[model samples]
Target chain A: MKLGVSLYSFAGDLQTGALTVDDALRYCAALGCEGVELIGEQHIPNWPNTKISDLDHINDLCKELGLEIFCFSYYMNALSHYDRRATMEEHLEMVRLGAATASYLGTRIMRPAFYGVPVENMIEMIKAGLPIAEKYEIIWGVELHAPFPPVYYIDALEKINSPWFRLIPDFSCWQTAGAAGHFQANDVETLRPLLKWTVHCHGKGHVFDEHGEEPNTPYKDLMNILKEYGYEGAVVAESEGWITNYKPTLDVVKTHFKLLEKYGR
Target chain B: MSVELRIPTGGSYALTEQFRELGERVAFPDLNLHKVEMDGMKGYEFKLRNPWYTEFPVSCAEDMEVGINGYAVQKGKIFFVIRDQAVPFKYAKNLYELQWGLGEVAQVRMLDGQLQAVVKEANDVEIKFLLRTAFEGYHLPNNRIEYEFKRNMGVI
Candidate 1:
């Protein structure tokens, strides 16, 4: 199980310049993250206001630190009634540009979502988005985010229907303001069948402590599943730092690293 | 300590008025829903649902940047159908009402929308009313709104 982190957890500060790319890389390296997921919006340019040159320094900095980008996060709802067809086309093109940048930076995954479509339309959207994915040789994965419905792993894979299309499993995405029952009742075992399609993992952990510093992820269970299936890909910890703070979330990743090292097969 | 409003999109002006009335009835008189005019994209209409609800829409714009506490309502000003159900599941009466209790559950599009969530538990009416009052009194900036109406209420 490879480890990584979605820089989104720190995006607010990063956007304000309080957290630099160096700060994030050091944090990831310190936490033992093998890679980092770049939030394309915070760093990408030209959807009208992109400062393309701003990321030049960032790309150079990543090379110096030996850090790798696991995925280019492009989480958008392509299926909205709000925009005209041109809007959708524009959104997809922006993702293509993002994929090209990710490729240049050495990552192969870019996540996009067709927001607002009926569950039945998931397959069509995934299939429709394929050419764009192929255009960049980027594996476009749809995330099982909290706001979206509880999409089953198998059904999700079936709907996506392509090697170019896949799942970016956020282990903790199932956790919400709702109780642990929602997570406990999930069919994690069923995911074994879809492991091959999982390109990236949102390695988010949530502890039940009121202080918000506890590590409550079922790492052993997750690792056991991954190991049993021999899954090898970037499992980037999407930080709960927004819910907790930076240090605590970083500490949890460190703790997770220790756990993965100890119990990993 | 940041607060936001989520509205559903694609509904008619009647539904939009109802949503606004609901907010004003609970006293967010200053609440205004604006149309987002971004470059190279279609414009969508949306309105404010509830500002007190913690979960707002995450807007991934054409620029590939996604921001929380914001949403892009796809069709019209109203996109979701609003209903009040007698929740069978337990929840807090207000944001302050339940210090540790899980709130009530309202049966939703059992199988509809982006989140396959059967039910999105928001604060109970009492809590929502109270929170709306408290925040309105505190003078908060209306951060974001989601489109809640998707079609003509009479049709759905």
Candidate 2:
């Protein structure tokens, strides 16, 4: 499996202006990442309306650094309309934009979080977005994050049985300890059944012990499971330690890369 | 120099403590509020962080109020700036077209001439705003999360 880092991992530094999008990409290269993921809304300037020149600049920079743009992640804030939920057309427009951006970045996979939207609506949105996904040659990975089990979306996945619509299982689902005290661990076994539908994965890391192991996530077991399932997609390291632990983002992400190296094979 | 409280309707104290720790880490030790002249008006500007884990639209900002040396600058006087475009807090509700990128510092400017009195070499600054999480099913009363950043900062 190829190891990668998401620009989202550098969120704290990015928010504080310690690093630019170009600097973050170079940092990932310095960390020996074979691939990298970009969050459109976060990394792309004037997103959903970002200038083609800026997109071309980022694409050229990635090529210069020898880092593969593996995945593009974006959010669908369906409830951002204030008094009402965003209409299906609004969500579809976002999908089109996301797909176009991902296509321009030369990434085949896109992960979207349908925040505040119901499961049924999320399924419909994904279904509606499949044509755009196909047009852009992108695979839409519905992130299987915590507070929701892999099995919970099995029905939805089956409904949208197109090749373009798949899953991006975040390792947070298996977190057993650490800063994620509020999120109960989802049965790791449940993920085994969903591996067939996963096109990308989020190697979510919070606090890591002295041994470069995350006490919160069972990476060894998870790696073994993925290996057993013959999954060979990119495991994008997403450092979230800064969220609650206030740890340095670069340090956490570096350690997370090490953890991925140890078990992400 | 920092104090933060989460008025969660029914969340765990442990989680609240975690968030408090988070607030402390992300909080700027110095208010970093600076004096600037914009549109021929003397004003105060400061960098604001997107406190959420993910990016949110500028429209998500609601009921914003800024305090400088105990003086409160309400919504009408505050503007959230992104990519050099400034939108007033009161009008940001319908401007979901603009987003606050994660780790990207957006400027907050208060142009009300009254702010001139509170601008000093070093002042206590506090900014409190309601952020709409906009998650459909997950309810936080008023569909908003409240955040406050208070610090004793030196003017640059």
Candidate 3:
């Protein structure tokens, strides 16, 4: 399992122009991250407006840093009621555009959220997007948010009807929901079976208690599950704030990396 | 356009049912709820607050756009509580295909159809309520909300 960070954690820096995409990648490289999850809006300037050639420049930079591109994160709510087809078209085009860009970046996974409408509409919307995903030979990895029912996640994936399309499970959300006894995130044993289908993962980090270390991810247990199943996707640190105190977060991830390295088959 | 409101938990079936009711109330001839079963449910247990407070559109933009000039087409608004679940992307796909963007300006309006210019606090309230509700509904402990949206009610 390769480790990485989503650019979202650096959103404040991006807006302030304090960090460039290059700078972010450099930081990741410095952290010994094997990859970086590129949130287009954060790392790619002129984003939806960015040209294909511009992205190639980024791909080249990643190669130079020895950093693999994990996925292009585009967390959007597709269900806001809009007045014009032009705007809706623009949003769809953005995804289609990202698909092309992801292809160029040597990864075909487009990470998105299933938000806004109810689950049925979410499924319909996802189904409608198949053409775009298929057109670009890209997989649609819906990041599972906590309020969304697990049934909806499964339903939508099955409906999308593509091996390329799957769920990018946010273990935190799962844990949160299960903490209430509403669902269960602890069943890593069950998830282990579906390892082959997992394109990537969002290793969201958080503090369970004040004294607990940053990114108190149940890493060892998760890694054990992945190891048992021979799952080989990047367990990207798709989180925020864990690295604000860069050293500690880096230590946490690096330690996890070592653990994965030790157990990784 | 006409609008009707209902309250249901945050899931697809509830929203589709509400939409169907709204479409029927407005006399739309054809409306379809695409069917599919999604796996790896993540946030199913999050409780909904006042789940009865769902809205259905009463008008179509095609009609309003012709008469209103900046006067822009009034994309109908629906107000509901959303917990800090995964960001919903499928909603956009459905709306795009169905031809509705989150209004023109992404403004936040109240349940009574009044725009709340200073919606940042109110937006946070929605999120908090949803999270609390989800926790109670699911019986989960220690899932604090980490992010939220307070931007315009319109879509970008």
- In order, candidate lDDTs are 0.45, 0.76, 0.46
lDDT per residue (tens digit) for residues B56-125 in model 3? 1111111111011112112332222222222132222232222111111111112211222322221222
* Location of the lowest summed lDDT over 10 successive residues in candidate 3 chain B: B61-70
Compose the digit string of candidate 1's lDDT tens values, residues A177-210: 3332122324456446557778877756544344
Better of 1 and 3 by TM-score: 1
Q: What is the TM-score of chain B in candidate 2?
A: 0.80
> Against the true structure, whose DockQ is highest?
2
Write model 3 residue lDDT over A211-257, tens digit each, in one string: 33223456557667766666667776544433222223334444443
Instruction: List candidate 3 segments past 4 Å from native.
Output: A77-91, A149-151, A176-187, A193-196, A208-216, A242-265, B1-156
| Per-residue alpha-carbon lDDT of candidate 2 for residues A81-193, written as tens digits (9 for 90 to 100) | 76677888888888888888898899999886675134676677777778988998999888877656556567777877888988888887788733474346666787798
Task: Give per-residue lDDT, candidate 2, residue A209.
Answer: 86
- Best-matching candidate per TM-score: 2
* Chain B structural similarity (TM-score) per candidate: 0.17, 0.80, 0.17
Error of 2 at B110 (Å): 3.3
Q: What is the DockQ of each candidate?
A: 0.03, 0.33, 0.03
User: Which stretches in model 2 have alpha-carbon errors above 4 Å?
Assistant: A116-118, A177-181, B1-24, B27-33, B36-43, B82-84, B111-122, B134-143, B154-156
Error of 3 at A136 (Å): 1.7
